[model samples]
Each structure stands twice: as C-alpha cells, then as structure tokens.
Target chain A: MQNKMIGYVMILAMLLFGGLSTVQAADGAKATNPEAAKVEKMIADADKARKKAASVEGEWRDVGKMLKKAKAALAKGDYKTAKKLAAKAKSQGEMGYKQAVAQKDLKMPSYLKY
Target chain B: MKHLLKKIAMLAVAGGIAASAQASPEADREAFQNFYKNRFASVPMEEYPNGVYSIDPVGRENWEAIEEFPPYEPFIDEGQAMWEKPFANGKTYKDCFADGPAIAGIYPLWDKKNGMVITLPLALNKCREANGEKPLKYKKGSINDILSYIAYESRGQKTNVIIPKDDPRALAAYEKGKKFYYTRRGQLNFSCANCHLQNAGMNIRADRLGPALGHTTHFPVYRSKWGTVGTLHRRVTGCNKQVRAKPFKAQGEQYRNLEYFLTYMSNGLELNGPGARK
Candidate 1:
C-alpha cells in the first residue's frame, strides 16, 4: 500500500511539473526564462505608461512660460532659485513640455551631438 | 567741397549696402528660428543616426605619431587580426555579415515583431554566436575588438538608421533610448542631450562643441588622446566621468539602449570611423 502511494505521488509531481513546462515552453526553442519575460513585460508597461502620458498633452505652455522665467532667473544669476526652478521645471517639463516637443517630432536641435 | 560731398554720398550708400549684407545672415536666422520648431528631420540621440551611414567627408587630421596617445594603431591592428581569425565554427567574422565597410548603418534599429532593441555592437556579436561561435567579449574581449575591425569595414556605408514604428520592440527601444538621454544620471545629474545636442557648437570649458550629427561615423576612433580604439559606450562612460558620475560597465543594456537612442538621434548623419575631435 505504501509503494502504491509513493508511485501515485511520483506521478502527481511529474504531472504538475509537466503542466508548468508546457506553459513555459510556449516561447518555442528559446529558453525564454520567466524572469526575462517579466523584465520584457515591465519594459512594455513602462512604454505604455509613457505613451499614454504623451497622448494626454498636459499644459506644457505653462512650462514654456516657466522655462522663460527660469531662463530669466538664470540670466540674473539667481542661482538658488534658478537651480531650484530648473530642477522643478525639468521634472515638470521633462514629462510635459518634452512630450509636446517630442511629439512635435522636431529634428533634434542641430547643435546637439547625436 | 562738392567732390567731398559726392564722396560722402557714395560712402553712405556703401555703408547701407554693407549693413544689409551683414544683417542678411542674422535676419535669415531670425526668420527661420521657429518656422520649423524641429527645423530638420531629427535623428534619435540613443545610438546612431539614419540614412546611409558614412564618415564625414570633412578633411581628417591624422595623428599617426602622437606619443601621449598613439593613434589607435595598436588597437585597430589588434581588431583587424581578430576579425580574420576563425571562430571555433571555422567562420571568419567577415563571413558572418556582409562586407564590414558597408554595414555600420544597420544598428540602433527597432524590430516591431521581436520587441527588442538592437544596437550595432550587439548585432556583430550576435552574428558570431548564430554561426555556432562564441559571443565576443564586450570590453577587452573579441566583441570589442571586432568593433574596430568592423569599423574599418564600415568605412563607407551611408548613415541610414531606420526606426520602424510598427515594431513594438523598435519603438520600445527608441523610447528607452529617449528616456535614457533626458533622465539625469551621474552625480552631476545631467542628461547626455543637455550638453551634447541642445548645446552643440557650444563649449565645455575649452572644448568646442561638435554638432551631434555625424557622430555615429567616428566610433572606434583612434583618439590620440586615449590611444585606444573606443566603442561608443566608452565615449558614453567618458561623458559620465566628465559629469562626475560613476560610469556603468561597457556591456550594460543601459548603454546599449542609450546607444540606440543616440544613434536614432542621428537619423540622417554619416558614420565615419575614428573621426578627429578635440
């Protein structure tokens, strides 16, 4: 009776593992580890978030106005506020103004190094 | 008195003409300033640019004998030998791709189906591995060596990197690259685009800014300053160092994605190996 139970347990374990193998093996020949798939998914999620954020089109004009102000502050050597505003503005602009500009799909400013 | 007045009249008219001539350039510049917010077809800033990658036909200043950093002859030659050497699979690196000189422009591309970002260096080593050969080492490895060797091969391909939007992988990589540039890294917390692209033709202290265009061509350049044939990532590391940030390793995906982004920024620039820069 004990031997039969052991045999039954062995079969169950194989079935469980085989079910998992079938799911994982779906990617075909490539190893396609779960971790790698997870990473790929995370990347995809990030991309989706970025695209959705891009489409919403927030108030970048506020940033353009703020950037104009920041530039003015910087030119006046208000280094403290200029730096703070630049930082604050960058976060705001990085997402907003940047998205519009990127969406404009403007040529990278020619002066920039690729 | 009459002759002097006549001379004055002529001088006045000449002055007006000269003023207009001088103002013409500035006037045109001002006129076009925002006409096209993105005036030219912008290249991606992650890897290399697009459209017929070739070296700048600009005159080159060869540094064949600079001692502080010998032209990367040593590294370049080493790379050449590695390229010709057979892999365990009996295939030369040359056999894995089309002629090396014309292949520099295929990288920093997106493949929608694969959802993967492929950079030039990764592709080179990938070909080797596909032929039942070992992947070349990234830094101080066969892969790194092949870059210079392959750079020699890429001598004349037109810079043409096409980022296919349809490819989820390509688009994803492009976005990754774009973020990498804008995201401030390093202790200084500056983005690569901050100094290089936006401020092209400006200066970092005494160094003159280069227009980011045509940058893709100069990789594996023999920097007389460094005496090494550098991969694009090494340059990225150098940029990090300048900003006081701890640099990433040569083979990290971050750099690869950055390369993709940078190269994409160069959408229509040429790819010249080992171009001279200050």
Candidate 2:
C-alpha cells in the first residue's frame, strides 16, 4: 500500500509539472513568434502610409483608429491580428491620399466650367 | 505651306486666349456673373445677395415673413452692446477697426505683417485678445452675435477683397482657397462648386441649393433650421460635415483662405449679411 501511494504521488507530480511546462512553451511561442518581426515591419509600413495621408491633409478618422488598434494588438503579442489591422489601416490611408490628389483637378459639369 | 503656318498661328492665339480666360479671376468673375444673370433674367443683380429667396417666390414669401420680425434682431442688439462696451483696457472695437457701418465688407483681407488672411471675426477676436480679454469662440454665441451686428452695419457695402500682386503670399492664399473651392472632399466626393454652381436653383430633396454668386454677401444668417444666427464659417463646417468631411477649425488658415476666395468672387455684390434664411 505504501509503494502504491508513493507511485500515485509521483504520477501526480509529473502531471502537474508537465502541464505547467506545456503552458510556458505555449506562452513563449505566443510572445516570440518568428512572424512577429515581419508583422512589426508591416505595422511600420502602415504607419508611414498614415503619415503620408496626413501630410496632404487627407487622413480619415478610421485610418488613425485602425492604426491605434493595430499597435495595441501588437503590444498584446497578437501578431496575426496586428498585421491584419495594420494592412487595413494602410489601405485606407493610401486610398484617402489618392482621393485628395485626384481631387486637385476636380471635374464639374460643362455649364459650371467657370 | 503659307496657309498651314497661318492656321497654326491662329490656333496658337486661340489657345492663349482660352488659357488667359481660365487664369484671370476678373474674366472668371465676369463669366460667373453672366451665367447667373442669364439664368435668372427676371431677378435683379441687387437681389442676388438675398440668395435662394431671390429665385424661389414661395421661399421668398416665407423669408420675408421671417424678416418682418427677424430672429437675428436680438443678436444685433447684443453685438451693438459688445461693440460699444469697454474692454479691460477701456479700448473698444472701434479702436481696432474703422468706426462706421459696412466695415465687414472689407474683411478676409491679406495681412502683410502676418502673411495670412485676416477675417472680420478673427479681427474681432484679436481685438479682444489685444485688450486683455479672452477671445470669443469662432462659430457660436457671442462671436456670431458681434459678427451679426458687424454684418448688419456693413449692409449694402460691396465685397471688395483684393489680392495684391506685390505679395506672392497673397496670391498663394487666394490660389489655395480657389483650389479648396473646386477640390472634391468627403466620402460623398463633392466640391463646393458641385452643389452651389452646377445645381444652383435646383432642389436636392426638399432644399434648394443656392448659387455661389453673392454667397458671401449675406452671412451670419439667421438659419431657421438652427433657430439662431450662424457665421459663414459655421455654414462651411456644416456643409463639410454634411458631406462626411472633417472640417478645418473655424478662423483657421484653411477656412480663412476659403473665405478670401469666396468673398473675392462676390466682389461688387452688396453686403446683406445677418440676413434671414430658410
């Protein structure tokens, strides 16, 4: 009976240690994914785009908001989510700038040509 | 060979004239004025300052009724008091600007020292700040009231904004304002000219889009929708918001420049501001 109880205690200890080690490994992967660097670069690129939009006074409110969210997600170690948000922000910023540049020569009806 | 050369010369001359016509504000103004005059043959030039009311008979009846006991009257009274009241240093608005009626028409002027446009409302705020008082807000309440009085005082004064060729900055500001007027913005993708120029006198839903001609003549308008008088910048902000565009600050450089351009377009039209509108 003594031997059996000792065996059971050792198994319990192993299970507890194994579970903790697995969680740590998962956390490590979450915090230090190989893709994190690529996402960081993408976020930087998106931020540059946002700045370009703002330089021409063409930034929309959503572009800024999305960039903020992207940075927040990045801070939380959610690289995938951060990359997605950053990409969206970048698209919006580029589009806003394009719209402003295109509008530099506005089109009006022939009657309103003056 | 001689005939071909002559044709080329004639073509070049025609192109030059066309380019100059587009480039000259005076030429553009003449064309703009003629467009309105020809379109609304029955309406007199003086009445253009009245805006949509000058064109829409039923709207005019309603507008006249509002004018009989104008809501802006109290604001003008308030403004008169503000203008006459002494500041912290015992200096009044008179010390800042020429004391007389119709002074508002001369505003949105280029300030050589500042290298920027100085609008009447901005000038009023500056006077306050100069006199050791806090400046009034640009779009509402006491500021609008004082502007109302000033506009009322300036009634019948023709807009006469000048862009002195001597100052490159002055022309730059005017050009910026003109670009803004024609530039499409907002999610709706419309320029100021889209509604005011092309669709003037036309109905968009229930409201008539007023002409760009004499648009600046009557400002600080008692818009029935707002149930209070609003400055031209306020109207601009409202228009921008309506189109889903974020507006520049009232009295800011963008707006000041826009006012300069718009007021220049209304040159020779009588100032009829603090007017009633629907």
Candidate 3:
C-alpha cells in the first residue's frame, strides 16, 4: 500500500511539470520569433517618425492610416506586408518634415513683386 | 575695432529694414493685386469677383448662361425661410445679429476679446447655440442654405478686412495665414500660391486653376461638382485634399486665419457670392 501511494505521487508530479513546460514552450516560441520581433520594431520606428513630423505640423494625411494598417497586418502574422507598409510610412514622415523645414522662411515667390 | 563694429551695425539695420518691408501687410497686398493685374490686364478690378470667368472667356459664356437660370435659387429661398423661422426659444438669428443679413462683408474679423479670428459661419453657429438650437456643421448641409441667403443679400458689399493696430495677436494671425498660403504641403508638394498664383491660368489636366486675387469675393458658391452650394471653407478643405494633404478642420484656427489673410488680400473687391461654379 505504501509503494502504491508513492507511485501515484510520482505520476502526479510528472503530469504537473509536463503541462507547465508545454505552456512555457508555446509562450517562448511566440516571444522569440525573429520575424514578429522585427516587424514590431519597424512599426515602433514608423510611429516615432510620424510623431516627429507631427511635432513640426508637417505630418501627411495617410501616415497615421498606413501605420494602422501595418499594425493590423502584424496582428495577422503578415510580416512582409507589415514591414513594407511601415517602411513607406517612415519615408513619407521624413519627407514631410524635410519639406516643412526647407520652407521655414516664408519666401515670397519670384513672380510676386514684393 | 570701432570701424568693424560700425560695419556690423549697418548690415544688421539693412537686414531689419528688408525683413519688415517684406512683412508689411499693405506691401504684400499691393504685390498680390499687381500680380493678377499684370497677368490679366483687360479684366477690371471689379470683374475679379467673377473669378476665372474674368479670365476664361470660353468658360464664361457657359457660366453666364447658368447664372441666368441660377441653380442656387432654391438654396436662397430655403435660407430666407430659415432666417425668418424662430428658434424653440422664440428668438431668431436677428436677436444675435442686430445689423441683419447684409453683413457678410464685415465678417472674418479679428475678435480682440477672444484673441482669435471669428468667421461668419462660426458666428452663425454661435448664434444658434445661444438660442438653444444645435449648431450647424461648418462644411456642409443646412449651413450652406443660410450662407447663400446672407451672401446674396450682402452682394456688392466690398471686401474690407480690418487688422486692428491695437492687437498684435491679430497681425500674428494674419502672418501665420500668409505663411500657410506660401508654404508647400502634402504628398503633391503644392502650396496654395502654386496653384492660384504661380499657375493661375495654367491647366491641370482639364481644369484651369483660378487666380487667387478674387478668391474670397465669391463664397457660398454653387459648385456643380457638389450639386449644391458650399462655403469657402468647404472649398478650401477640398483643395487641401486634392493636394493629398490632410485637411484642417472647417472653421478651425488654420482655416479662419487663412480666410482673414485671404479676405484682407481681396480688400476693395465687391462680394458676388452665392456665385455659381464648375
């Protein structure tokens, strides 16, 4: 009876430890996936760029919408689509900021005689 | 050392004079009107209120025909009804505007107390809210109806926007508006000046870009594109989007300041609003 009781205790410990490891492994796979991590970083970089442009009142209309689509793509595991959208958004943000900065001084056009 | 210091002071003073000369509102307006005058020498200053029709003879024929049987007639009638109708509180728009309907020319004025630009549409909405009625939307719908009537009533009234000397903020608002006009924006990289000034007569595909000179004179325009009348701010919003830029809110600071600058530019031109447009 004592030996049987010890055997049952050993089985119970194995089942508990095995279930915990399975859950941890699943979580580890999601956390360590390089593609997902890369896309997340790209999205974050795009958002930062967009905010920088907005700080100068130079943000384009579609940058926010593009970032939103990128996040949705990332959620659906579409890393390639997500990356492309994020990169385009970042480029637009940079262009808008540069455009605004270039015209910091209100230069009257040559055609208008001032 | 004294000689070098003197040279530096002279250069600084010269630079300061140049900047202020360029910044003067009167100087800017003169330059703006001259550009249009030089471009279209035949069109009288009074005719600028007709917009592109003053320049585009071919289009003007069609426009004249349309004006004979104006599409905006119904809106004017509707607006009159709206004007006469009392609010739930037994108060009317007259209660707010003692000067009455023919007061379009005096608006887009700088409100010193608010430290901001107050436009006609904004004032009308304020009147509504004060009378316990819901404020009308700025860009579209019933607002256009009332504006059409007010604009028609205010016809022939000259555009005269006053920037008070007492308030430095008013001048700042005008300067900001001027900056907005000249500054390039959107994916297309076009400023308001690029289309309406630099290439005013140039064709962008099928459309001939209109001159900026009398832009503010005609408002609450009957756009065939919209199949109804719309406000100047509505047209401005459409222009921003056409350039692929995010449009600022209608009647917001950006647009109100823009109107203040634009109307100031059109000073002395007659108001022919509720005008028909393609």
lDDT of 2 at B10: 100
For model 3, state the Cα shift of residue B242 in Å.
1.8
Clashing pairs in 3: none
Best by DockQ: 3
Lowest lDDT 10-residue stretch of candidate 2 chain B: B16-25
Per-residue CA lDDT of model 3 for A1-114, tens digit only, reads 753654464456447776454334323334756777788789899889888887776778899999999877765556789899999999998988888888887777778876
Error of 2 at B18 (Å): 7.2
What's the alpha carbon RMSD for model 1?
Answer: 18.0
- Backbone clashes, candidate 3: 0
Write one digit per residue (lDDT tens) for candidate 1, span B40-158. 33434322331112111221222222423545546567777877778788877668665563566687666465556666677777877788876765644445556766665666666
TM-score of 1: 0.52
Task: Sort by TM-score, best first.
Answer: 3, 2, 1
Scanning candidate 3 chain A in windows of ten residues, the lowest lDDT window is A21-30
lDDT of 3: 0.87
Report the CAPRI category for model 3: acceptable
* Estimated TM-score for each candidate: 0.52, 0.79, 0.87
Q: What do the candidate models score in CA lDDT, each in turn?
A: 0.52, 0.79, 0.87
Q: State the displacement of the C-alpha of residue B272, model 2, in Å, after optimal TM-score superposition.
A: 1.1
Superposed Cα deviation of residue B214, candidate 3 (Å): 0.8
